[model samples]
Target: MKARFPDRAKLRAQVWNAMDNNPGTRMPAFGKYQALSEAEIDAIVDYLYTL
Candidate 1:
Protein backbone atom coordinates (compact mmCIF):
# COMPACT_ATOMS: atom_id res chain seq x y z
CA MET A 1 0.00 0.00 0.00
CA LYS A 2 1.01 3.62 -0.46
CA ALA A 3 2.19 5.77 2.41
CA ARG A 4 -0.65 7.65 4.05
CA PHE A 5 -0.52 11.31 4.94
CA PRO A 6 -1.98 12.91 8.08
CA ASP A 7 -5.63 12.90 9.17
CA ARG A 8 -8.44 15.40 8.28
CA ALA A 9 -7.96 17.92 11.06
CA LYS A 10 -4.24 17.48 10.71
CA LEU A 11 -4.37 17.80 6.94
CA ARG A 12 -6.60 20.86 7.19
CA ALA A 13 -4.23 22.43 9.63
CA GLN A 14 -1.36 21.59 7.33
CA VAL A 15 -3.20 22.94 4.30
CA TRP A 16 -4.43 25.95 6.22
CA ASN A 17 -0.97 26.76 7.36
CA ALA A 18 0.37 25.86 3.93
CA MET A 19 0.51 28.09 0.87
CA ASP A 20 -2.91 28.93 -0.55
CA ASN A 21 -3.40 31.48 -3.28
CA ASN A 22 -7.11 31.76 -2.66
CA PRO A 23 -8.24 34.37 -0.13
CA GLY A 24 -11.46 32.66 0.85
CA THR A 25 -9.36 29.68 2.02
CA ARG A 26 -6.24 28.93 4.00
CA MET A 27 -4.61 31.06 6.62
CA PRO A 28 -1.12 31.59 5.32
CA ALA A 29 -0.73 31.57 1.57
CA PHE A 30 2.90 30.81 0.97
CA GLY A 31 3.93 27.23 1.54
CA LYS A 32 2.67 24.15 -0.29
CA TYR A 33 -1.04 24.48 -0.99
CA GLN A 34 -3.36 25.35 -3.83
CA ALA A 35 -6.94 24.81 -5.08
CA LEU A 36 -7.26 21.05 -4.91
CA SER A 37 -9.14 19.48 -7.80
CA GLU A 38 -12.03 17.07 -7.31
CA ALA A 39 -9.85 14.09 -8.24
CA GLU A 40 -7.12 15.32 -5.95
CA ILE A 41 -9.65 15.76 -3.15
CA ASP A 42 -10.93 12.25 -3.87
CA ALA A 43 -7.43 10.88 -3.63
CA ILE A 44 -7.07 12.70 -0.31
CA VAL A 45 -10.40 11.47 0.97
CA ASP A 46 -8.76 9.71 3.87
CA TYR A 47 -7.22 12.94 4.93
CA LEU A 48 -10.42 14.91 4.52
CA TYR A 49 -12.96 12.21 5.29
CA THR A 50 -14.30 14.16 8.25
CA LEU A 51 -15.13 17.24 6.22
Candidate 2:
Protein backbone atom coordinates (compact mmCIF):
# COMPACT_ATOMS: atom_id res chain seq x y z
CA MET A 1 0.00 0.00 0.00
CA LYS A 2 3.01 2.20 0.50
CA ALA A 3 1.30 3.83 3.45
CA ARG A 4 -1.33 5.27 1.10
CA PHE A 5 -4.21 2.90 1.21
CA PRO A 6 -7.03 5.20 0.16
CA ASP A 7 -10.39 4.36 1.69
CA ARG A 8 -13.69 3.80 -0.09
CA ALA A 9 -14.44 7.50 0.03
CA LYS A 10 -11.10 8.31 -1.56
CA LEU A 11 -11.60 5.63 -4.15
CA ARG A 12 -15.02 7.00 -5.02
CA ALA A 13 -13.60 10.49 -5.20
CA GLN A 14 -10.88 9.36 -7.59
CA VAL A 15 -13.42 7.68 -9.85
CA TRP A 16 -15.69 10.70 -9.68
CA ASN A 17 -12.86 13.10 -10.32
CA ALA A 18 -11.95 11.23 -13.44
CA MET A 19 -15.54 10.85 -14.64
CA ASP A 20 -17.10 14.14 -13.46
CA ASN A 21 -14.56 16.71 -12.30
CA ASN A 22 -12.23 16.13 -15.18
CA PRO A 23 -14.86 14.82 -17.61
CA GLY A 24 -12.48 14.57 -20.57
CA THR A 25 -9.32 13.81 -18.66
CA ARG A 26 -7.20 10.77 -19.39
CA MET A 27 -4.46 8.89 -17.53
CA PRO A 28 -6.43 9.70 -14.42
CA ALA A 29 -5.01 8.51 -11.14
CA PHE A 30 -8.34 6.85 -10.49
CA GLY A 31 -10.11 3.89 -11.97
CA LYS A 32 -10.01 4.80 -15.64
CA TYR A 33 -6.24 4.53 -15.69
CA GLN A 34 -6.53 1.81 -13.14
CA ALA A 35 -9.97 0.51 -14.08
CA LEU A 36 -8.72 -2.67 -15.64
CA SER A 37 -6.05 -3.02 -12.97
CA GLU A 38 -7.67 -5.73 -10.96
CA ALA A 39 -4.29 -6.67 -9.61
CA GLU A 40 -3.69 -3.19 -8.29
CA ILE A 41 -7.18 -2.93 -6.91
CA ASP A 42 -6.90 -6.27 -5.19
CA ALA A 43 -3.53 -5.35 -3.73
CA ILE A 44 -4.84 -2.07 -2.43
CA VAL A 45 -7.97 -3.69 -1.03
CA ASP A 46 -5.89 -6.27 0.73
CA TYR A 47 -3.67 -3.62 2.25
CA LEU A 48 -6.62 -1.48 3.33
CA TYR A 49 -8.28 -4.43 4.99
CA THR A 50 -5.28 -4.75 7.26
CA LEU A 51 -5.80 -1.21 8.47
Candidate 3:
Protein backbone atom coordinates (compact mmCIF):
# COMPACT_ATOMS: atom_id res chain seq x y z
CA MET A 1 0.00 0.00 0.00
CA LYS A 2 2.91 2.34 -0.45
CA ALA A 3 1.62 3.72 -3.72
CA ARG A 4 -1.68 5.24 -4.79
CA PHE A 5 -2.64 1.87 -6.26
CA PRO A 6 -1.64 -1.23 -4.40
CA ASP A 7 0.35 -3.85 -6.29
CA ARG A 8 -1.53 -7.03 -7.14
CA ALA A 9 -0.18 -10.58 -6.96
CA LYS A 10 0.91 -10.47 -10.59
CA LEU A 11 2.67 -7.18 -10.07
CA ARG A 12 4.31 -8.54 -6.95
CA ALA A 13 5.59 -11.52 -8.92
CA GLN A 14 6.97 -9.18 -11.56
CA VAL A 15 8.88 -7.27 -8.94
CA TRP A 16 10.04 -10.42 -7.26
CA ASN A 17 11.41 -11.90 -10.46
CA ALA A 18 13.09 -8.68 -11.38
CA MET A 19 14.74 -8.58 -8.00
CA ASP A 20 15.84 -12.15 -8.36
CA ASN A 21 17.29 -11.30 -11.78
CA ASN A 22 15.41 -14.12 -13.40
CA PRO A 23 14.88 -13.31 -17.03
CA GLY A 24 12.83 -16.47 -17.50
CA THR A 25 10.34 -15.40 -14.88
CA ARG A 26 6.96 -13.78 -15.39
CA MET A 27 8.21 -10.22 -15.70
CA PRO A 28 11.26 -8.80 -17.33
CA ALA A 29 14.40 -8.34 -15.30
CA PHE A 30 14.00 -4.75 -14.27
CA GLY A 31 16.33 -5.31 -11.32
CA LYS A 32 14.56 -2.70 -9.23
CA TYR A 33 15.24 -4.50 -5.98
CA GLN A 34 18.80 -5.41 -6.83
CA ALA A 35 20.09 -2.88 -4.36
CA LEU A 36 17.91 -4.09 -1.52
CA SER A 37 18.82 -6.76 0.96
CA GLU A 38 17.02 -10.12 0.83
CA ALA A 39 15.37 -9.33 4.16
CA GLU A 40 14.16 -5.97 2.89
CA ILE A 41 12.75 -7.57 -0.27
CA ASP A 42 10.97 -10.20 1.81
CA ALA A 43 9.40 -7.54 4.00
CA ILE A 44 8.24 -5.53 1.02
CA VAL A 45 6.88 -8.58 -0.77
CA ASP A 46 5.00 -9.59 2.36
CA TYR A 47 3.51 -6.13 2.63
CA LEU A 48 2.44 -6.18 -0.99
CA TYR A 49 0.52 -9.40 -0.41
CA THR A 50 -1.39 -7.75 2.40
CA LEU A 51 -2.46 -4.91 0.18
In candidate 3, what residue range of length 10 has the lowest lDDT sum? 4-13
Rank the models by TM-score, top first: 3, 2, 1
C-alpha root-mean-square deviation, candidate 1:
8.7
TM-scores of the candidates are 0.26, 0.35, 0.40
- Give candidate 1's whole-model lDDT: 0.46
- Per-residue lDDT tens digits for candidate 3, residues 1-51, read 546336455555555465444656665443364656556666777777676
Candidate 2 ranges beyond 4 A from true positions: 1-29
- Once fitted onto the true fold, the runs of candidate 3 whose alpha carbons sit more than 4 angstroms away are 1-13, 16-33
Q: Please list the C-alpha lDDT of all candidates, in the order they appear.
A: 0.46, 0.53, 0.57
lDDT of 2: 0.53
Ranking by lDDT: 3, 2, 1
Error of 3 at 27 (Å): 9.3
Give per-residue lDDT, candidate 1, residue 8: 52
lDDT, candidate 1, 1-51, per-residue tens: 123444454454445444333546536432244566445544665545544
Error of 1 at 37 (Å): 16
Off by over 4 Å in 1: 1-3, 19-51
Model 2 is weakest, by summed lDDT over 10 consecutive residues, at 1-10
Note the residue pairs that clash in candidate 1.
19-30, 19-31
